[model samples]
Target chain A: MTLLITVFAAVTVTIIWYKNAPDTSMQLGTLSLMFWGASIMWFVDAVVGYMEEGASFFMQDAAEMLNDLYLGLSVVALGLIIWLVILMIKDPHRVIRSLITGTNRQ
Target chain B: MACFLVPASEAVITTVAEKIIRSKEKNDDSNNASSVPKVRFSDKLGWLNKMLWGGSALLAFEHIWHGEVIPVFPFLTAVQNGETGEMLAEMGTAGVGMAVLVTLIWGGMLAASHVIENRKVDISSEEAGQ
Candidate 1:
């Protein structure tokens, strides 16, 4: 379930990153890469688990699936927050820098 | 239960490797006008580090949420529950599997980027000739 969610996020973000390729300042590529990486990680986890638990690997409890889904979403949200921080620190558009400069001038 | 630790530890190694590589490549990026620019090894290593660290972090969080890991000693709950054998088996399988797969994926990504970089160089050369 977590793997599926991450794969979904990875695909969605990859598309957005591609569309926004003209603007590299936002660093959406980093977010996209992180999601893709996580998806691959979870893919392996799923495979290993299937080997261990056989067909029952997919037969997780509803409550357990819900918890995993929340975890997946939380990971996505955390990634977004980290990316936002990077964007602010990068100030690729110089937004923060200009703001500070303008305030200093005033 | 302890699967996330494997990738997390791998992340630490790669992080240190990136630092060393970065220091070594501090002044090697100067390309002549006719030269085709190439990606830095350090930057590629950085990308790998990011992947491992990001995935491991989220996996750890997920494990914690499931109560598979705890804050106290013998941090994995499976250890405390006398499921040591099962936990070790999981670490051997899921932990190693994730680490290997992520590295393989990063390799593919690196290859794709290298091919694109070369293609860009070829196009520019063709345009220059014209």
Candidate 2:
């Protein structure tokens, strides 16, 4: 379920990035890449889990599913946090620069 | 062999670090004359990023509220307590719904930006003609 959520997010972001490829900035690309990376990681995790648990894996109880959901959301949140840090570092539009120079409003 | 590998790796690391530092300095100089427009606090992309962060915070809070993150690996079957099946169903629904909503917003933004760019181009061409 966590894998599914991340995959959906990744696909959605990728489609948006694709449609606006020429004009879109690196931030969007960064977002897409992060989600896609998480999805791939979760995919491997799911595969390993299934291999170990076999058919029982599909029959997860409600609590386990809920836990997976939380974990999935955490991963999504972590990815966004990383992206935020990247945006701060890049400061593409010079917002940070302006702030530092105290000439932001001009 | 070990000594050779270690020094070779150190040299590679040092070269990469120097390159990164040089590029960062160059970027700092060029940033003053960057072509990209300055971002305002009310920028649409900025709003979107904020919204994403807000959602993430809410999810984190939810995880904490349910105690799904403390004792063990939440991704695996670590917790022994079980939840109602209905609650599980609702969570699944909500998760998918949130994903869909976010995607729709991003798509809308993309379309809006494209239209805005085209209009700007048209206006510029008109000014040039005049």
Candidate 3:
């Protein structure tokens, strides 16, 4: 099923990136988990929809749309998560300085 | 519409500003004290929580609009297949179920990630503080 393929790709990509990357600050484990989980769910749903008795084109279309939504959100969320991770890892000092500015804490 | 957009925009701006400030604080602490860690557990969890809530809102809106409102139009329903009701029900159930699952998983993973990350950061910060 398309959903299954998408989920597989997403999860595989995430694990590969997470493990092989020299700097895991590129992707947070939690965000990757979310992407994988959602993709898997969509994949499962698609498979089930196809096998269910009396499944129609209308229903199939709806299911596909739902999967698309999940995939889109997963990409957007992961992208943001990756960027944040990189930002934090690369400039902890600048971040710290900004926080201390105009604050009571020294 | 303007009223809605204005409040939403303001909230988004506030959130981004807060995140930048928080990240800066963490970095500052790390510098004066190399012992401090770069990221915190709560920060990751907070972002995950926000996403879950945002997703829930979108799903709810979809449920109301497609599952209820659109299907209820008199002319549309008159011409639509009798099975429209059943189809809507299925869509509603599936959409809601998936939404809930994602939200719960995200929350749980966020919590776990937070704990692990926080422990690492705490160890570093403690050393730095010393």
Candidate 4:
């Protein structure tokens, strides 16, 4: 289920990035790539889980599914946080610099 | 060890940042000949970024509401014990649903923007012909 959710998110973001590929200012491609990378990681995890648990893996209880969901959400959130930090560091719009220098009037 | 994954993830983000910078520089050089205004980073992906941040905030709130943020050690244990797992599942479902909705809305906006831009071009060209 976690892998499914991440794959869905990754695909949606990738479509958005593809539509705007010519415009590189916003860096949505980075976000898309991050989600795709995560999706691949989760896919591997799901495959390994299925291999170990065999058919029982398909019979996950509600509690187990919930736990997996939480873990997946955490991964997504962490990815966003990392992306935001990188954006700040890059400061493509000078917003971070303005904030630090106290010069931004807008 | 799981903590080590954070740095590895960060390294990927750094590579993305470098890619964006390099692309932007190339764009600037190409546009210089045509005297086109450079695209501002904030303006380009502002909506998408906001949606991502908003989703993260919602997830964080849900985590806190379920007491998963505090008592971190117990939170890990609770995963195995099935405590509050149902609530967590519901929240996760809602969070992902919201993300999908946001993406759809952004796509709609992009299509609308493209239509408006095309209309403007058509009108300008018509006026110039007149």
Leading candidate by lDDT: 1
Query: Model 3, which residues run further than 4 Å from truth?
Result: A20-38, A43-106, B1-35, B38-84, B125-130
Residue-wise C-alpha lDDT for candidate 4, range A1-106, written one tens digit per residue: 6667767777887788789888766667667655654554444445545766898888989998898688767766776676687777887788878888999746
Q: How large a fraction of the reference contact set does each model reproduce?
A: 0.53, 0.00, 0.03, 0.00
- Clashing pairs counted in every model: 0, 0, 7, 0
lDDT of 4 by residue, B62-118 (tens): 355455555556543345466566545533444334444444555675677667766
Cα deviation at A41, candidate 2, in Å, is: 1.9
Candidate 1 vs candidate 4, DockQ winner: 1
Error of 2 at A105 (Å): 7.0
Per-model TM-score, in order, reads: 0.85, 0.46, 0.41, 0.46
Best by TM-score: 1
Per-residue lDDT of B1-130 in model 1, one digit per residue for the tens? 8888888899999999999888777755443333677778888987888788878877777788778988999888898999999888888888888888888878987999999998999998999899
DockQ ranking of the models? 1, 3, 2, 4
lDDT values, one for every candidate? 0.83, 0.56, 0.49, 0.57
Per-chain TM-score, chain A, candidate 3: 0.44
Please, what are the lDDT tens digits per residue for candidate 2 over residues A9-95? 778877988898875555777687557534543354455457768989789899989887877777667766777888888987888
TM-score per candidate for chain A alone:
0.91, 0.86, 0.44, 0.83
lDDT of 3 by residue, B1-130 (tens): 0111222333365457657877877777767864444445446545544443333333333233333324355423312546665654554555444545554665686677678877998887788789
In candidate 4, clashing pairs total 0
Question: What DockQ results do all the predictions give, each relative to the true complex?
Answer: 0.64, 0.05, 0.10, 0.04
Question: What residue pairs are clashing in model 1?
Answer: none
In what order do the candidates fall by lDDT, top score first? Answer: 1, 4, 2, 3
